[model samples]
Target chain A: MVQRGLLIVLSGPSGVGKGTVRKAIFKEDGVDFRYSISATTRKPRPGEVNGQDYFFVTREEFEDKIQNGDMLEYAEYVNNYYGTPRSFIEETLASGHDVFLEIDVQGALQVKTKMPEGVYIFLTPPDLKNLRSRLVGRGTDSAEVIEKRVAAAKDELKMMINYNYAVENDVVSKAVDRIKAIITAERLRVTRVLGELDN
Target chain B: MVQRGLLIVLSGPSGVGKGTVRKAIFKEDGVDFRYSISATTRKPRPGEVNGQDYFFVTREEFEDKIQNGDMLEYAEYVNNYYGTPRSFIEETLASGHDVFLEIDVQGALQVKTKMPEGVYIFLTPPDLKNLRSRLVGRGTDSAEVIEKRVAAAKDELKMMINYNYAVENDVVSKAVDRIKAIITAERLRVTRVLGELDN
Candidate 1:
């Protein structure tokens, strides 16, 4: 089999530590994945380059790409336009490398809609109590804000049914371990890299 | 964590080398797994013992278990009975050991219906050519029968979606390696072994 990268889309509710697992996959496991950068209409923050942090584009350019099929998937958030570019992913896949899309549930669905073969994995919180505790422990939001986040989690849980695989983040390190194993196992799936077996 | 025996169900298409992988898993990896002894209502063969190859029992006894919720799953054919008994599996799981059920897709599904939490894996033929070649090259079946087997295999592929994980049998060693990794990876699912997690 070719040493091609896997187009892995890891999405989960907040506080599930997907970022941590994503970083570990790159640093510890040597995934060699090219992160799919998003193109947004929002202004780039300080020290964030237009093409580096995001392809900071004008509203007209975002609209042109949306009409021209240049983006794999995109959405408007808080009136700010954001989209994943198709050319960037296509280039990486052509070079036989995997691309990682660290996006939300809606973004993942849009991606799946575009790339039916893209592997979608949902990282779930172990339990409700723990998910709530995690939201609180993060110390990033007020109690009322945490309540809203937990409420939003219920809606996210409903979307798990659409995902091909679900990995529980009870222990972030262990979740990372399973994520790696899953990627390894999926690499052996007949539909993808290996294709139909001759033997 | 207590070392509990896993009630493993291995089912896949013919000529996929399921038996070879099963043996290698134990011999090469030294993983402890018991091959489940099936029960039958048929009388013992000329040299067969009741509890060795099968736990031979009367029709009345087999029916009684089915009626009393004792038999795990059973199938009758050609005036003979084949069933998996509940006692042995329950004992094995409780004894901190795992039992390996090498059976067909129907049998695996029956066991899953009885025990939803059991680990389920489906092995696929390495490729369409290897699949057909293996069945025909074996020369155990005539061309007509071989055609029928291949047709049946096409139908079996549909059930791959039902399996928790799918392992493709391309390279025997590679298949075994992924399967070993799967079992190891499953141990980390968290939902499967919550009690084993550190506090």
Candidate 2:
């Protein structure tokens, strides 16, 4: 039997560039993992593909999934339900395909409770000072708002303690390289590769 | 203070190409880690540098080190004592330089007892059949001897349970790449990088 694929969760505080890094990882060649497409009740955009983009579903269907525990994690926002379908992830992993999830810290924590074996990676800024500067450099938020955001970022950084790895998003390519290395290394872990020996 | 560097121990069954893989890793540019130099009581061959090749020392000196508990692990062969010096490894790590030890399984187990935090990697052949073929390809051993060697290899393969990773030495460069990735991923482990966050 083929070994189950790894579940890699990438998360961090707001504006730490988790999305950007995840996008870069997918774009890179030789990365063999599936991007988890979330199921959402919101209407699809003009160009969004049904399965390629989000797994668009009706509100009733999404709610039923949540009620039946089919949703790995779900959240309601602006009258729309969004969640990861439990069946898809399980089936994909069973077929020996890795599943990558890019989510927020709170969402990642929820996934962790459900899949403790997943590799949780916290994408951190170069440093707290750098993070604060990036927040301030936005120039869109007021000084008071930036200060509050900085404080919130500090709290989010504390959540990194729960992660298996803390990768610095110092450079997009560098962070991608590190994440790739992480996946490669994880695959070689004795716990994961021992199955081959048994054969 | 600089973070103490990691102690990476690479070992596996005899004739698994651990030494070849290690040499390839060091030859690759951008790979950073000190190859552990062993202390030995045997006289160095011509052109072998004092510290570069081996820390050649008198038998009395080697014995005194063992008495003082300065020898990390050692064994006597052909009436000559050979062992790793504890101080050199400690000093290198304390100075923020990773120390790599390429030793036999027995020596690796001894080092693991002393440094439980070290990353122990077991280099494995692609398969038992392949290992047997390699042994037979030598054309020097009798069939009975080859059979005994394969049996010993199987027992050694069982020791992989104690290692953090089991890398198949199918190709020298691929094995080197996996080892490099292991080091990269290890450097990002939360337990190790959390110290940077504390600042």
Candidate 3:
């Protein structure tokens, strides 16, 4: 029996270094994983490819997919539709490669309502101070915006209870190693293996 | 808040090399773990130390411990008492060291009833043929006994559903690595970390 891949949902507050940890995980060269791409009705920005940056589609096309249940989860923001394409995730998993959905907590919870079996992991900053430093390091937001983010992070920390695993991103490499262990352990889950056998 | 240790129950079929995988896991440095020692009323064989081999005790003493609810689990074989002591496991776990219980499926399930939160892992052979060869290689059992063990393994395989993880002992090192990953992941469980915070 062939084992199918896992659908992993990674959620965290902004500036938690999730992207850096994920990059480190992929850079290892042995982690067979793919990032889930979102479909959006919003127009692509400059230098952003339609399929690479986002699966840019018309509002009608995105709504049609949602109506047909092709979207894993969809939401309308600023009159633009954004959703996870179910077909790509299903296809990638059928091909025996893990798929990662690096979504926010709200979106991740929405996905859980649709696909409850997916592994939900929370990446947390070591502390709010470190998170503030990281946000400042990015230099993308004003001090007021960083303060708002820090406050929001406190609220998100409470949501850690909703996750299956919580890994502290004190060190990017250590955080990646913990996530890798989680994926490895999840692959050996009895329910997953039994499903393989029954196939 | 300090994180507590994990109670890990490792169980599988008789010939599945659970011991070897566990040995390899412990042989690696930085894995702070201890094996649960059982108390037995059976007399120690030559070259077997009382504390190192088994906690050799008189039947009266062993039965007294069981009567006092000090035994986590116990069984009688040929009028000899064998049981896991509760005090040592609690002490080891309190000291923040993972404790491995290498027992059969029956014993593992018994422990689960007492400690429902322990991580239960099932170690399986790659295939029935390999399991049979392993049983034969033991050279301690007769052909009839080997056949009985093989049949029992089939029954035990079904019990994998009761476990959290099922690791195939195809390569000893690989199996050990999977178990180590499980321990690492289990330590990051949200509930476990939450409890630490509450303290």
Candidate 4:
């Protein structure tokens, strides 16, 4: 009996170490996990690989996919469209590979509305002070932007009520371990196991 | 901020290796786990300790505890009463130690109705044949009794639908690992973490 893979949605406020934890999970060998390559109209960064990091697409193509109902969830930010393609996730899960979707809180909420069965995990910082320091350490945003992010994080913390699990990113490895445990436990869920065994 | 420990309820059909996996978990170090000692009117066999293996009590005392709403769940089998006391489980969880309740399917269902928040895990054999062999290998029951158990296991498999998680006991170590993962994942539940951090 082949078990269908899980759709795991991971989200948190900016600079909560979601990327770090995700990288750690992928670094481990033998995990049947696949990152859902997002379709984005935004230009790839210097180190980013098209189709690998993100599915770089033309603005018109992204909009066309949305129009065709091909996008699972999509949003426009800074005049660039970013969204998850429904077909890739469906095909990957059908092939028995767990798909990880790392998006913002808003985008995750959108995905939750569409795929309520997906595992929703909220990554959190140890505390507000740690979050501010991490955002500052990134050196990607101005101080004003950092302050705005901190304010937004406080609001995001409240939104954790909507998530099924909350993993604290105190240590990157510990956060990854917790997420891995969640995935392991999710695979053993009676609904999934019964369906697999019944076959 | 202390996160309250989880209440983990484990139940499966007889001879499914629940005891083995549980013993393996307790043998591991650094696990703050407490077993919920059950109250039973049955006389303790050799090597059994009061308040450890079973809380031996008179039939009248057991009935009184049930009447006083102290028993979490209780049952009579072959004129012997076996039950879990409500206070011990509550106190253990309140003191931040995860309490493990190892019981049968009937007792687990009864406890579920009383403590809906507990994590319910159903253990199962790889197949009916394996279950039969395991029951027979125990050398404690006759062929007739083993047949009755095998028939009952088929019915219990259907009850898996009502359980939150089902861990297959194909290998004792693997089952223990899955259950530990479950406990780790449950601790990261959004409600628990949020409440802990809010304090």
Best by lDDT: 2
User: What interface RMSD does each of the candidate structures achieve?
Assistant: 6.7, 3.4, 5.1, 4.4
After TM-score superposition, what is the CA distance of residue B62 in candidate 3 from its true location, in Å?
A: 3.0
Runs in model 4 lying further than 4 Å from the true structure: A41-61, A128-154, B42-53, B56-60, B128-154
Residue pairs clashing in model 2 are: none
For model 2, residues B12-87, the per-residue Cα lDDT tens digits are: 9889998899888889898788989999999999999998999999999999999998888999999999999989
Residue A172 displacement (Å), model 1? 4.1
lDDT for each residue of candidate 4 in B1-199, tens digit (9 for 90 to 100):
3457789998988888888888898887777688898899999999999988889999999999999999989888899998899988998888888898888888899899888889999998766435666777788989998888777766877888778999989898899899999988988888777666531
What is model 4's DockQ versus the real complex?
Answer: 0.42
DockQ, all candidates in order: 0.22, 0.39, 0.39, 0.42
Model 1, range B71-115, lDDT digits (tens) per residue?
Answer: 778898998778999888888787888888877888888888888
Question: Distance (Å) between predicted and true CA of B144, model 1?
Answer: 17
Please report, in order, the local distance difference test score of every candidate based on alpha carbons: 0.76, 0.88, 0.84, 0.85
- Best-first order by lDDT: 2, 4, 3, 1
lDDT of 3 at B198: 25
Q: Model 1 over residues A1-199: C-alpha lDDT tens digits?
A: 2344578899877777889878877886466778998999998888998768899999999999999988778888899998999888877876788888888887888888887777778887776434567766788889998888677766765677567667877887888778777777666554553344432
RMSD per prediction, one decimal? 7.4, 5.5, 6.7, 6.9
